[model samples]
Target chain A: MSSTINLFMAAHHKECDELFAQAEQAVSEGDWEDGLFRWQAFADELEKHFTREEQILFPEFEQATGMTGGPTQMMRMEHEQMRSLVNEINKVGTARDMDQFLGLSESLMVTMQQHNMKEEQILYPMTDQSLTNAQEIIERMNQ
Target chain B: MNLHKLSLDTIPPILTPFRFFLSALLFGVLAALLLLYSREDFWFTRWSNSNLALTHLLTIGFMLMVMMGALYQFIPVMNGQLIPGSKKLAPVIHVLMILGVLALVSGFLFSNSELFQAALAALGTASGLFALSLLPLLISRLGNQLIVYLLRVLFLVLLITLGLGLFLLLGHALPELNLPYRFYTDLHVLWGLAGWVVLIIMAVSSQVTPMFYVISEFSPRYLKILSLLIILTLVVMSFYTVFISKQSGTDSAQPFIYYTLAFLLSAELLVFVFYTLLKIAQRKRKIADVTINFYRLSMFSLLAALMLWWVAVFLPLAHLTYLLAILLIYGLAISIINGMLHKIVSFLIFLHLQKLSLKRPEAMTLVPNMKQVISTRNSQIQFMLHLLSGSLLLISVHYPALTVLAAVFMLANFCWLSWCLFQAYLLYLESRKKILACPEISMSL
Candidate 1:
């Protein structure tokens, strides 16, 4: 019953959160290998999340609501912001600049969480309310 | 459908909250100076003029100012609904609050009826205007989220607190107006402190703790039930104050009801504080965070205050209530806000700068990271100062002779906080200038 976009997307958010937190924890404990592993995992999952929303969900939301330049656009902009932050984080991680990496991680964590909050709280619910094919969209997201 | 209102893009111009925050720092400084000027004698009684002035300065001037500002920013973000006409009205409300708090503080200090009258007018108008601005959002089609529900109740209690305050002020401004002064005063303090302030803190903490620290989320159902119970207890206590306690002396069995309510409140808060502490201690990403330090301090202070509250109920001591106030207000409430201020101010600056970077890719390099906006070193130093000052003030309750020393630390604490904020603001301005000077380049999202 809760297989709607809201539940699907929100579960993905929590997964990303856990992965990101594990990476940060590993880094804090000086486990560079595990840290980078977890960090890459988190980044990959996050990028996939963005792709799912930007590719499948947002377009459906825009077309269904006929509001192409609305919340979806803002979400798109925030996604780009997070992407940029993530790229910086990758650089810091590669350099093994622990302090800088941690700092950027904090920044990314906040940016990513707030972004996820908007998507989960506002966008996903709106998508569920407005779309008739939410299950299908979620299925596509899974694929 | 005005879906734009629900869009997360609607950040109030950053100055909306910053003005109130910087103003709060000024009040904190003023409170410190007032403590220095009044010396240890202000500790003798809660009813003393200077003590009342100091209390108002902290509660209304510092705490309420910051809380109101935070609300203006957070309500929109959380509920995804904009306050109507926030751009213009927010500044006006900020100015009115400044005037109102100053007038009220001066009225208390100088025993000036005219200042009390001025305070009444300014504060009443400001509260009314603020409540009006929020009315649309509160009544609108907000989701049945715990935060929205809590804010709705918090706002109602705030209005009641203000109404009681206004009546009390009227009694001061016009001595001939027969008012149940003691009764109303107790009720006002209870509603203001326990109802409005504590409730808002609980609501904000539930949201903030898990999100910021990457801890497990609080059970929303449990929190909602707890909030409702707190409100219900307050309602019952108010009725007791009105009917039962007013007619009887301390020896009456009705006083047991008072004790019971206090015990309930203390137990509830104990649960909140312990849970929060455990969450913080168990945070997965254990890093050297100044905010965590502040949170720990505030939680411990809350625990101490709760313990002392129980002791006060058992043994009627002169200094216990005063100690409880210090622990609650300065130690707990101010500590949390101070911690939040560091994180929030940095986050806000970083957010706005991020938007600028979006407009121009050349500016992307210019945006400072969150920690760079307020360096960890500076924030940690400020936290230490705050802890030292709060501890000294608590000690000054027993040894009034230490008031000057305590005031000195308090002054230093607030001044340091102001300087930290000013430093961040300067960094922001510097970054903005460098970014703006760079060639504008189109960036696609």
Candidate 2:
């Protein structure tokens, strides 16, 4: 199961999902202040999660597999798309354009769901199987 | 382990699924026209020529066609692998299925045993090729349990259902070779409606409902049980019908087994529907998109069918069979498919365009958002038309004249649906043309 690697990474997704729902709930109810606060927290957590994968897991995977222009490359490109989406979301400013926010937020959700599904279902298990010292890798990434 | 499965390449060109969607829409309209043509027989009898034809039109012609497309599109993303030969084999599979279903419809309409034989041969061959071509790819990606496992089971059951059905048609096809066990018909229907249809919908929705609607994962435990209960009921009923019927001849098989199976299946469906409604109610996003509206409508239709299914077991009410068929087949299954068609098509269009725009930066401005891909007004009209047809069809059971009106509404709904999807296609084409023209800033796709 690659308990450390898979669970640790997937838990971040669960955490981000919770915050995302909270922000969405707030916005749907037209609570801008709370919505912004929760949304910011979600964005920050999401960035951290993305960084963890991009820097640590994907590199370790690429090194082990030596398949540079494959799944990981696609993941990086999708990350770029998501990051650009997050950037646009951040620019919504103080005047709450709830419709646009929700629209883009929906996009972010789909992007994240697809990205996370591939990572959890495909990449993590593969990494778990191939890596000689996953715990050490996890420890290094944790640091 | 084929890492290529996880990449965008696994996602076939848009036409793969769009063709299926467009065909399903056309078939839906065809079903409507058939309904209008056979308005008298359609309302009068469930097993009559026109009624049987209409059911096939909706079931095999429309629903299965669309499902084949969606399965191809989603298998990769869902399992992190592409179905082998998905691109090349699709057209062949599509033609066979369309021809097979049309033959079945004609066989029923004309009471022609020859057409029945033709349908069995065509459909069996098509489904056999379908399984051989695609199931292996999906099976190899069994990275997780429960949902994936259920999907695998459903695929097998689907093949069995087709085989059993073909077996039944054989006696009629060739009067020279007689096969025993007349009750295989009930077994085939049990597997098709309960096992295959119910399980696949539950399995797909477990992932999709949460992903598309931004709802949390709602019903894993219950969904797993619901799927299992449906299968268990199917197996139990099959045993009671086939094996037990042999034990004491025709008299041994009682209505009680049928009664118990119906109750068990209907109860599980009730839980599933309620759980779905709960999630939709608790959904965080409340913008009221057409897809969301479709989801709500689908759940309610399922709920209505489930309730009526329960009642139909106790009292054999007139038109009860037709009512349940409409509710289950058209109301629940078709509505969900129609709802997903919008999301899958729109998302796929946006995805390819996004990928294209990334490569050819000059075409960035030409790229469309999800909304622009299909106008809200168009989908709203489609949904309303869908609701209108469903209502009129429900009423047509009592008044046969309204069957024509119901068919009109259903046909109109599908026409709008086809138009909406075509618009998305044109938008995609426009993006492609503009992107291809600008060769200056080309990145390899």
Candidate 3:
């Protein structure tokens, strides 16, 4: 119960957001190399965050609450949508299509941010409440 | 912990808000064209016959239309409850409102009693039905406390505004009431602008700008304070109008209370504009967007309007009030609405398409991404036309002939806006057909 699910997950979201912003800034400056590097870091961090939710947190929360389709379901769906966008961004980055990359990146950034808001505001708080063994879950998520 | 209370299923159909958006563009073009044909003397006073018609065409015809549609969409997002009978009521209200505003405008323009009566019936019914549609959702447990509070007040205030407007209209329609039409009309304007429009915009911006654009969240404490000041000012103004005015029987006290509330209202709006500007300046994304252009222009226009309004308090200038009204209504309000359309329309298209693709992955190949729904280049051109129109409008006050140029700009801007949305809608239709052609759709969250 002392795992601090909201703060820990929220901080990870912030980390991903910061990386995304750096990638975005690089693309804006027409530095495709830096853009790709930062974007890869952001994508990797995002995948880890998704794994923590999908593999550990969401299953645990669903089991505790016995609710399969709800906010988490929506979040998972949005994450899929974002993952596709990330793929498009990666494709454009490789092609060095600056205009295309910037456009796709802006779209991705909006989707990601709104998704984070919903998770941070609704899902994480619910996870904190429903999961009794939150401290262990946090340790596992950290790992 | 309230995740069960929130669901993405609560959102209304995509067409609900788009219907209003398209109508607003039509009305904007109409309002501009109406200004072109009106006599030169119409701009001389606030109460001139044609001026009344023109103003209502913009305020009721355009602004109110868009706001109602947005509320239907916003309530579900902010409250997590779909409004009961919304699908059934939205189209009905839209038709009623369009008919009502047209009737009202023609009545004002021609001084026809029959048209005034028709206007009363149409507008009154439309406003009532609009309120009825929101009743169920308003009673639900809203997640955001600030938005919940503001919406409750805004709903009530909208009815009050409509009721007062009806009272004034009756004097013109029936001619038996013999009311001081101007007296009640001012109160009607106050509640409409300050109570409904300003409050809702403030409440939405408090959450939306932060989330959608990745801007830093504003201090809710400051918003709470601003809300209180707004309510207090409205209460004082109402108290003065309803009670104190009859006792004094003089025009002197009216101007004092009016100016005081005006100052306080503008100050609150200035704070909103200032905060929005800062948020945009510090937004995480540095890439150029048509929506960002609209937002920046909206803030600057709002600030410019407030500054001009402040200057008029000390210096006397002819028709300065008209200029101030232009900037506040068209410059600030319409500009923000345009900015919001770019984002909201795109978001809806993007969200719905994703949902469709999720339902049938095979149909995804036919789906266009968000960036392709409404192209940046097309909207940028739309924004340029808007900027040119707005600038010409400001200068149109001194030289009446310039209004023709402004009208031309407005016509082009609106035509482009309509074209952009039409293209997106066509894309939506194509994607929708592809999804339907699939054998089985996965009906899941």
Candidate 4:
């Protein structure tokens, strides 16, 4: 059960990284149109991933453990931070200020990767261990 | 799978400090406008005493106030650990900052007066103290490299800029001070804008962009290195140019270096935009919230503003350059701030409401959605007003009446935003009261 959750999260992380790289390439080449498209795609993936965690995984965890606030709240806050950056990037993108855009992207990338690492290595593994009905949860999530 | 619930009471008191900062920002904006109006007589007079007043109001008063408030609220959330001094030191810093800004602005306005010189020294001391207060939290959280680096750089730049400004003030008071006023003045502005404001914004945004959208994470190493490199390059180039231009007695090389720096900065900004858009695009969430819409609009505007800047830099039209600056500063910067303000206010309110709900779920009835906390209608109207004012102000360079109209609209829009923020605050308090009245519920395990 734990392995499945780990695998799913790992795959998602990899996909996200790949998308980020593509966006970087587009930016470096000054392909605003394609860059915008790819970047939006990356943001979408993240939204979906977070939604699954918040709605499906988090609720189940809360029900099982009766602890509701800490992890979920932290995750939500991180989500807020990411959204703010996206908004900033969007603003900079509209201005077409390449230097500001690149600088912001570089900083954002680092913060996000670290956030993912904590979730992947610590939180997700802990969840997998605590939830005995993990297989069922994974199947439901997949479905 | 029960997660351990962290008590709301245990969370550090960030809201009180933020309120003080917000109040400071309000005053700062008003001060800036008043200073600008006073300088109407000699609008193009660079390095004038009145201009100094306006600059300080904008930078120290408005920008720093907001930045400090945000850091107070966000740092703990980011690190998953609360700052020890947050509850105690925030108020102290806030008082110092406000008094410092007042003193500094007064000093700049009365550059030649002995009393004003003393005031300036006091303001500098207050700011130094405020910076010192933040050192502990900053040092403890050195793990967040982007923020840490930005804070360090901002501190250094603040010292340089403020020191240069003081020198200029002394030079005004005592002509024998023998200061190279113009050189230091230019360097001061450059450092304040690029080093302090831009760097901090970059650092905060990196964490925020992904967090807001629940997007995949960014590459941390790349971000930290890029930010450091940009700052280093800008600092080196600014100093080199300042000294070289003075020595060589030529303005020819100035434009080249400025343009090169601008191009590099633009490239960096573009990368950020692209990366954020990519993350948002990949998000699985189907719901289109107000925050998301504002975020999208801001991103689009950033790109448009950048293009305009590029054109303005290359083109020979003075009016165009002025217009582009307005668009970039007021249009892009304000829009992003407005959007983020909406979300931040709403989220904070929501969190407070949820905390109350824990004690009394019934009291949660009045808790508003993110949209209700900030009226979308008001925001839309304000955004349009901002756009119109920006356009008019640009044209105002030729037609004086348009400038007055621009100022009027801008002020009105800002009032509307302030009202919305106040409304959110009231709602938050009401919700808190309801929670306090209700009986706490025991956890069901």
Scored against the native two-chain complex, candidate 3 gets a DockQ of 0.45
The fraction of reference A/B contacts recovered in model 3 reads: 0.31
Model 2 lDDT per residue over B1-445, tens place? 6554356335777888877788888888888999888876677656577887888788788888898898888777766666776788888888888888888888988889899899988888888888897767545645656557767777777777777877877866776787762557667766877667776777777778766666677555776666777778777877877677557777335777767676877777777788778887766555567888887888888888777766766677778777878887878888888878877787888778777767665665566666667656777887888888999999988788788899889888888888888888998998888877765563442
By DockQ, is 2 or 3 better?
3
Tens-place lDDT per residue, model 2, A1-143, is 33568777777787888888788778868998998999899989988887888898889988988878887877888887788777766766255887667656666677678778877777777778778888987776667
lDDT on C-alpha atoms for all candidate structures: 0.84, 0.77, 0.77, 0.62
Error of 4 at B200 (Å): 2.9
Clashes of each: 0, 0, 0, 94
Report the lDDT tens digits of candidate 3 across residue range B1-445.
2566677556788888888878877887788777767635556778887888888888888888988888777666555556665687888888888888888888998898889999999988988888887776567554555666667767777777778888888988987778788777877877776666666667767767766566666787877787678777877787788778756886466787778877988888787778778878887766566777877787787688778878888887777768867776777677778777777777677777766777676775565666678877777887888899888877878887777777778778777777887788888988888877876665666
Give the number of the best model, judged by DockQ: 1
DockQ metric for all predictions: 0.57, 0.38, 0.45, 0.05
Candidate 3 wrongly placed segments (more than 4 Å): A1-11, A132-139, B1-6, B39-41, B253-261, B435-445
**Candidate 4 lDDT score at position B428:** 74
Error of 3 at B121 (Å): 2.8
Which candidate, 2 or 4, would have the higher DockQ against the true structure? 2
**Top-down TM-score ranking:** 1, 3, 2, 4
Tens-digit lDDT track of model 4 for B1-445:
2224222123455375456546644764575366337534424554566656655665567666776676666655544444455677667667766776676667666654664566556566656666676676566533345556666666676676677766766665565777667667666665665455555555656667555554555677766776676677667767666777667776565778767777887777676667656766775432233555555555665676567778767675555534544554455455566667766766667555654564455554445545556665666765676566656655666665565566666666566667778888887787677677877767431
DockQ score, prediction 2: 0.38
lDDT of 4: 0.62
Q: Judging by lDDT, tell me the better candidate of 2 and 4.
A: 2
Model 2: per-residue Cα lDDT at residue A120: 76
Predicted chain A of candidate 3: TM-score = 0.95
Residue B198, model 4: lDDT of 51
